[model samples]
Target chain A: MSSTLRSFGAIPAQRLVRTLLLAMMALLAACGQSSEQVDDMVDFSPPSEGVSSAEKQPPASTGNALQVDVGGALAAAPALPPAASLDEVAEAANRTEPEPLSITIPGLDLNQVPVIASGVTATGEMEVPSPLEVGWYRYGPTPGEPGSAVLAGHIASEGVDGAFRYLERLKPGDQLSVAFNDGSVTNFVVDEVVDYAKSALPFDELFARSGTSQLALITCGGDFDAQARSYEDNLVVVASVVA
Target chain B: MKKFVSVFLGALLSVAFFVVPSSAQSDDARIHLIHGIPGVNVDVIVDGNVVFENFAFKDTQDLSSFAGQTLAGLKVNAAGTDTTAIDAGDVALPASGNYTVFAHLDADGAPALAVFENDTSTVAAGNGRLVVRHAAAAPAVDVKANGAVAFTNLANGQEAAADLAVGTISAEVVPTGADDPVVIGPADLPITEGNSLIVYATGSLDDGLEVITESIADLGPNPTVVNTGDSPIDAGVPVGAGLALVATALIGAGMIRRSQGITVDA
Candidate 1:
């Protein structure tokens, strides 16, 4: 045993003591260093936990690529059976619900004016549009669809005339056109113009969602009451889809 | 060995610090699963992964663990198996809104799935919103709240909603134009304040009948209530012409009722 240990003891005492002191100083330096530096010194292989993140999180697939276990074996379904293929798909794609983008009335000298899809006001009346623009009732139908699509515009706001200021001037056989988001234009022929009391505006016929396709152009008319801040009556131009 | 311990502690501390803020920003969509099909256990698969396993019939599961995301599709499969039952193909789940996925039969009495956009907007102080969805395989029917016809001729896949004072609500269903031999029931359901109660009628009269009522409370604030249709005017009505104004409003309301041929709720 003594002969075996002779090699380790053969080193000079001073050199051995210096070597131990150097090792202790290196350990203290490592302990004083930040964890970030320690991380750089260490090897960080990916975790050994079961599956990798890539295998766990697969990309979402479209349509019917689902696996169906049949008779203890996995089988992919070709596709789910179709349900009202055309209508459902169109509705799901938000296609069939058409929205008007602009309107043109040649009789009233109203060219393609932009339309904003507006809803009922806080007071429950139809919302009026901005100056030089028409307001399409969002609850109503598209111009070409089988229903009454209503559009309202301000007659005057702060002394400025609106796009539908002369809507009451249109007569029967006057041509009007409406453009939709799908770039389709629907032509209409003016049927008649009628003045209704603001309190008596026909709610249903002016905003039907189904039936023969029609359009109702509306604006404030009759006497203006400063106390009420509105006109006494509304002028509505009824038109039908002719083309 | 000391170096390894320090590196491990550093990595753990960094991970712990980063995880807190990321989880706090999570806005997961709320999903409600109603097993409406008769006698079949199901598993809900979202984006190719099974989220709910062994979901049984007439069971309602609120998926609190499902963090909302735009899923490719929501599929229903047989429990413990991969057989696809109903596929609501490629529907967008809003970032953080309540949704109910109805697995019911279509008009032709075939298994189908319909995703209805829920209106969780707040109700009045003492009122709750009740939305009745006719998802059954039966024909057009009338829904009665406390034995009074609230909705008429509601066809399959259509929904009608009304705001009601909070109380125990008794509801029944009958075939269109008939009153007796109730097809569904005179069942009682509780309506809580500031909540939205959705009742779905599933299954057919011949096979089976089931009702899945889901309630979500503490929506927000009351929606603005405004008078709609021909209400007797006092302020907005033109002054100095009461008789003429009344006549015009009556004539206009009558014409609307005749031409439109659909009841407008006042």
Candidate 2:
């Protein structure tokens, strides 16, 4: 072989040997895996037992894509169905029978004992102006009278916490209901929730008998006086049974 | 040199073969396996019909189990899907142990399922309820339990939903250009008295669907006729005012008769 050829072969041989050694060193360096990687892999162990979390949990989906957008969580429903055009839902809701109060407000622990005549003030006894709890306080002189059918409740109490704990949160339009003895129920929509002191309650308007059917939810609010021991004020919700 | 190279390449080939297979085997290792429910067996029944019984799930089974059962549209309980019906027999009699029924792969309480036996059926649960009366006259939804009825006069349409709960409530919306209410109140509205019905007088007059006593003489003051958009709900409850009037009238008549003719006192 020529001297030139021999030198060239020798140079190529040296470079080849160097490249292999570099590759080997790189591979050895990688052999020491990262500690973080090891930890993630260990945690790759399937999740522990199932847990329902309160922290904003993404809703779990199990059905076809169109599963009524439960807003994902079972606790809450989607936004209120759009109020149909008056022409749309014009038909009066068919209420065949009157239903009595079905539930108590969540926070308050009030007793709703059924009695025919709402206990009148009788001059001496302090008239329990409001219901023990504030919900649908059914009242009537008769089922279909144009007379005043009064109702009262506590805006807040430690027991029920407040019959209308959410009263202050009410907007102009809300709803209410009362059950009649005639297997018929009366419904009312809230036009206003006015907070007043106990003495300021519209005694005449609230306590008087009216000509047609109506309902009121009374509760004490505005101010609570520790000395008087009663709410300094009251919350009066005025609603009328839809005509 | 050739021999050395050959030996080194052979070693590389051996390492690749052994290392690859070892990894492949480890990848298949399942250290832990848990079935959703103990014994994870299930049975499904619908409308007194057996759909699936003690069905064990086969891994990778989308829905049907080894029992050849399909569950996607099974009608469950409470909030159960209405797509299909599930029966008591189809449930895995969990040996009488308390088992949580989770809907849609849930692990909690079973949902209420609605059977659309008629053209329209309402499916509701918890604070949510839907009432649908496929029939024309009768109320589509009747709440026998202590729950709320959110929708009434639920018109026939897809968007007609209700958010009724358990309690007495009234909801009425007057259409534009409706009647001006008869203004029945002292000053403000919705006054509740023993004999009087309270209402907030606003907007044009929107009529109610209430049933007045058959006899106007038995009614209080001026009786406004109730508007019924659809057939009235079947209720035998008479308007209370009539009964009160009859009682009062009878007492008055008896006193007058005694003054005019014969009474025990007279």
Candidate 3:
């Protein structure tokens, strides 16, 4: 064994092969640690300061005069018998369902793409819509509602390009609109585009319900892992409501 | 505690005209007012003004804008009449929280009031919260989800809660330890993700027992990951296979060199 080792050491070709093996092992180690390092650098910062400042605006009505007159009325009024039922009043007060129809991103050349209400799958991940459609996160606020509403789409599926294939191309100041079933359209301007590793996604900030009204468009990006058959990073584009 | 109902009403009357202190808190409290008293139409007065007129059974009003303010002289009167039925005086709404205030009946069939602070905490991903409140004039009961008792012996004026997966559940309320007479429903209730579905068992059991619901949304947790694509259309390179192939080639080359060296020595 010692003579074989001496012969192997004496050969320059064997020495070059050993150096190449060491380099390959180092490369493998770096690949394994890259995702963790990215996760450590993940920022959980809240929304922009300008958005939070708008929430401090004063309310329109104070109701001061009405507050003073409430005491005297209760003492003056006598107890009366229950009146006849009016079932119509209850029907008029029922809650209305949101009817989001389609999304339009002219910058991405996506025109009036249909949207469907999507929920989480059995494994707790957001269910992606079909290649040609966008999915609105029905559990969150609607597109025009006052919260962080999320919309997800496929970048590509089965070698075909999906609805959000050009989602990462969205830049700040870019415009988009979401049309509702009621014939109304809500416009939004792009705020920012971010790319996050799948393991380092800021769940709290991305899914927050209380904040300035905003919309999030998401798709897969970064390097593809063939063994896993998925992308390593998520591309997110955030847009604020246009006043 | 036999005078629980009157004592609670008296507390409201004493504080009906008191002023609320101003605070710098900016939390928004979402409040929903539900009229659960069956067979009666009423006008809901808040701070001396009739906010809801001719409010019938199961009628709901969003009082979220009134959060952080004192509802002085809050009263319910027979429709279009000055006769007061239930006066919840000077009720101070919380600065931040989801709440539901119901004008319901107690266990003894007397008209009463209930203020339920809803659970608005973050729900697990793909799951929702279900809250059951007994605001009816009835005995203790068992609340069932899909024909199985999820909450047992839930008495009037009490509540039970659970976090369930997002789906539709067939809900029914029955007497404790018995399933023959299903009281409330075999109704289909959709348990949506990141939202709380609060179901109130209201009215008199013998008169017209029914269920009213309020949904508080945006309580769902962010998904751990969003895998949108099954194939890589734009993913620049298939890095995993590339790295593995390079590593395999390097290892195989080294083995061939070592074997050649050993053969030369032999």
Candidate 4:
């Protein structure tokens, strides 16, 4: 065993100890580094869950209503067949026109930044547009719709500042606007700014299609990996429709 | 042996520090209630409690909160009277996914209840899902999208569905093997991406057939990763610095091996 170790150029015992210490430090630095910013005003529940049963209750009913006879009704109504299995058909050819054309954030001094619809890449990562433009997640809701619409932009690329470079500086109550193809504009108010580790982002909540209308502006933040050329965290700015 | 112990400890520590996020989707079922029986104002009672009074045709309600719960003595009575129209005893809502319950006429034109589960699966980008359900008191019909037969021979109480690119398509419903005498409209239907647009052939054919729609949204793939930036511009500590530290540690390990009289390869 010693001969084999020698042929492999055995590391000195002190140097091995130092290497182990450095690895430990690196591991420690990467642990429990949560940056989520909690906002009390935002209701994260889906729309269905938000409604109460009492709201569906009819106006005070007369106590004279008698118990319904189920036997006769059941005899008259035939039992429905089991749910049918859906058949796969050929794909349809028609496509919808993209709605959102541009976005504006007055507080950030971003005026009418061009927006483009984008989809996921082959690897399942969101395909980001150029630093000069913002990418709207095409599969999600459009801005001002009854769901969360996601828009992602770059903070910086290759030492150049991106369209969302100052996204972290946005505060609650900041105004933002989105213009659609129909020449209509929807205004929004920033609800909160949160920073999350990329691995820990709540994808369901960020892309939910129920509940109040929302817009999520996303960009890169936190530690940058030089080798991977990526950021370790994402900064999200959530905004709600101005109604 | 000491070196092996230290290396093992380092590996164990790294493993202990790794974090994995949970990716479980919510298990809450989305339920919608629709009134398809025309010419009658009714009171909807679930579990012997009147949930909707004076409910007219085309009135819809979201019953999502009742997911996973069974309602006993589900009854629809004439408005302001005790006359029972349809009684569905002990209806159990699904624990998850999307569903719609309709009060419509069966093929025999009798008041009946039909429960259809809506597909909530993620749609491909740039596409939308369309579901055609036959709930009217009509015979088997062919559903046309953009004047093409998309769903054929769809009988009462059955459903057919497909995914199509997001756009507007002219929809029409006609009797099987006949294009003339349309039972329903050639109305323009908008197919929005990430949503399942369910069109129901509702109301009795003799009483005037109609079409009602329900949309289930948010069925889209979440991006596996969002890499919005390149370069370490915002990083407090560059990853290269950490790599450098790791490289230095490896070099130290090499030095220690040399001190232990391990032969250095030429």
Model 1, residue B164: distance off in Å is: 0.8
- Tens-digit per-residue lDDT, A1-243, candidate 3: 222233234454354344334423332221222343223212111124422332343442223433344334333333322221222212322446655666778676665566788877656698777776788887778886777888898877666667787788899998888877666778889999999998787766776677778899888889888788888999999998888
- What does fnat come to for each candidate? 0.00, 0.01, 0.25, 0.24
- Higher-DockQ candidate among 1 and 2? 2
lDDT of the structure predicted as candidate 2: 0.29
Q: RMSDs, each prediction?
A: 25.5, 27.2, 24.8, 25.5
Q: Which of 2 and 4 is the better model by DockQ?
A: 4
Q: Model 4 over residues B1-266: C-alpha lDDT tens digits?
A: 98556444533332221100000113365667778777789987765557677878777766654443334456889998899888765454443456677888888787787777677778876677888888888999998888989999999878899988877778888898899788887877777667787878877778788776666766656787888999645333332343235334644664211122112121
- The parts of candidate 4 lying over 4 Å away from their true place are A1-112, A117-123, A138-149, A157-160, A165-197, A210-215, A221-243, B1-27, B45-51, B68-70, B80-83, B93-97, B230-266
Fnat measured on candidate 4: 0.24
lDDT for every model? 0.57, 0.29, 0.66, 0.65
Q: Kindly give the stretch of ten consecutive residues in candidate 1 chain B with the minimal lDDT sum.
A: B222-231
Q: List clashing residue pairs in candidate 4.
A: A10-B257, A11-B256, A11-B257, A12-B256, A12-B257, A96-B166
True contacts kept of 1: 0.00
Tens-digit lDDT string for candidate 4 (A20-68): 3443333222111112201100112223422232133343311011113
Error at A186, model 2, angstroms: 2.1
Worst lDDT 10-window in candidate 4 chain B:
B16-25
What residue runs in model 1 are displaced by over 4 Å at the alpha carbon? Answer: A1-243, B1-28, B46-49, B63-68, B220-266
Q: Chain B TM-score for each model? A: 0.65, 0.15, 0.74, 0.73
Residue B68 miss distance in model 2 (angstroms): 93
Residue A176's C-alpha lDDT in candidate 2? 45
